[model samples]
Target: MKQIALDIGLTPEPTLAGFLAGRNAEAVQHVRLWAESATRSPVPSYVWGPEGTGKTHLLRAARQALQSQGRVVGWLDTDTPLRTPFDERWDAVLLDDVHRYGPEHQHMAFNWFVNAVSPLHGKPRAVLAAGRLPPADLPVRDDLRTRLGWGHVFELHPLAEGDMRAVLRQSADARGVFLSDEVMGFVLGRFSRDLGSLMQLLDKLDRYALQTQRAITIPLIKSMLENE
Candidate 1:
């Protein structure tokens, strides 16, 4: 059988302003400062946490923030191709999902770490990395693993329920949709609570609302789920 993709609405690009800092406010602030080129140190910034802690979100936000300032940044993750070696002209590098890297990615990441910290002719470039484990506990090569801890390391935590509710409301408002308290309570009670999952649900509801020419309500949500 062929798979049918859900018509989820356009997702708002991840931005520092859109991120709900929750308990990770310091991490967010650090990333903001780093992206602004305010941090003088060449040491990399590392963030680690379980899934749904917004590790990828922070990385992408930093990337956008840096590029907006006319800085060249290279982004790498488990999915991004690693064909070229690290270049000094790039102002920064972002490595996502460091915990899941295989041997090849580990080697490439090690090179990125080394070159980012100690460029030959110019000022050192910043490196930002994220993973499921802290640098000390990462399973990558020992040398790369040690370098991951050379700078700031932050452990992100899941958002609080209040924070989650605020985020849902904020997202709904941004889309010009009214999410009732009833719908919010029902959705939060019924589905996965992770911000990633919740945002996806919001996207689907937004699309369903547009499709059916109706406001998002508990019944509409149920209908969408039932139709699936």
Candidate 2:
């Protein structure tokens, strides 16, 4: 039988204010400044780190910040089919998961990087990109890789256990639920430790709590896990 799964609970919007900068405080600050700066620099900013290190979070935060400021931004990722080259009307371009781009995506990324840095008309547009590896280590074309390293390059670090705990508690609070120390410890030990995974788990718990009219507890989590 084909089973359907429905998404439940509200996923918090990714924002700079919500980002928990543990070891990557400098990276977070740099992205914030770049997004908020009135003087647009041609030089692009790129962040590289392992999976689940908040690379996408920072990129999305920057996008939201720019859009809130009324800047037209073009966003692309490895999955986007770029049949046409990048347009110049955008005030900025955001590229996410650059390291996962295949050959055609690589071509598009290179073209977009060039156009963003040296547009034929007007000053250059700000370019922000994130990937899983450093520019030099990226498995992409030489030109695209070179452009990725041309400007500010930052490497993100994973959050500590203490920081992760704070994030989980804050998120639970936002969802109007209380996560006790025991539940927190169980979730941390029983599930994937990555922040993204933890957030998804919390969402599931939130939905289960709402559905059963019960507070999130160790027994609730155990039942949820058993059913899964």
Candidate 3:
């Protein structure tokens, strides 16, 4: 059975520790609850949001956490089909962009969800899924739609208003980089404003600043920008 390759551009390291769950705090906590051993297996959970809203990040985070605990976790992305005889050996399964599944696929997925949440083979085999719309708004099969909403459903809210800068400053501070307002503004102005890219730039600048024994000043950032 062939499966579609995962998106090459998805973030490489998406651990629970690394996720910057800003306005998605409550949702984040809900998802992480599945990782605890005593919390019960096959914990069917759903997280929904528009693209680039950390849905992929949180799904991968759960995968990493469960894998560390020695659970067999399966992850299927947007184009990947839910290949059947749906393996019950899996302790956790993460389905991303689930709204894309068509009628037949949805039926297969519905069955998988049913068994996962049921105590058929003891504690349920946990599942975490993400999509571009909430279960109620999803344009998939109604029965499948109802099942999706059965568990703890969370909406992955985008970062809070006006907090990105503070997040950058705090991240920089933690990494021992003095990201000045001027430089942060300049970087924000001149480069990609996405939180992920901005944070990566700040990290690289911190390393460069340490290597050159230079303060994180505008001039230093300017030089770094040139090399970048």
- Which has the better TM-score: candidate 2, or candidate 3? 2
| Candidates in descending TM-score order | 2, 1, 3
Model 3, 17-98: lDDT tens digits are: 6677888888888777777565554546789876557777688778888888888876766465546645778776677778
If both were scored by TM-score, which would come out higher, candidate 1 or candidate 2? Answer: 2
The per-residue C-alpha lDDT of model 3 at residue 167 equals: 62
Every model's Cα RMSD, please? 3.3, 3.0, 7.5
Which residues of candidate 2, in runs, are more than 4 Å off?
1-9
Tens digit of per-residue lDDT, candidate 2, span 78-144 = 7687666688789999999998998888888888888888888788899999999999999999989
Candidate rank order under lDDT: 2, 1, 3
Q: Evaluate residue 72 in candidate 2 and report its C-alpha lDDT on the 0 to 100 scale.
A: 89
Instruction: List TM-score per model, in order.
Output: 0.89, 0.90, 0.67
Instruction: Give the candidate number with the greatest TM-score.
Output: 2
RMSD of 3: 7.5
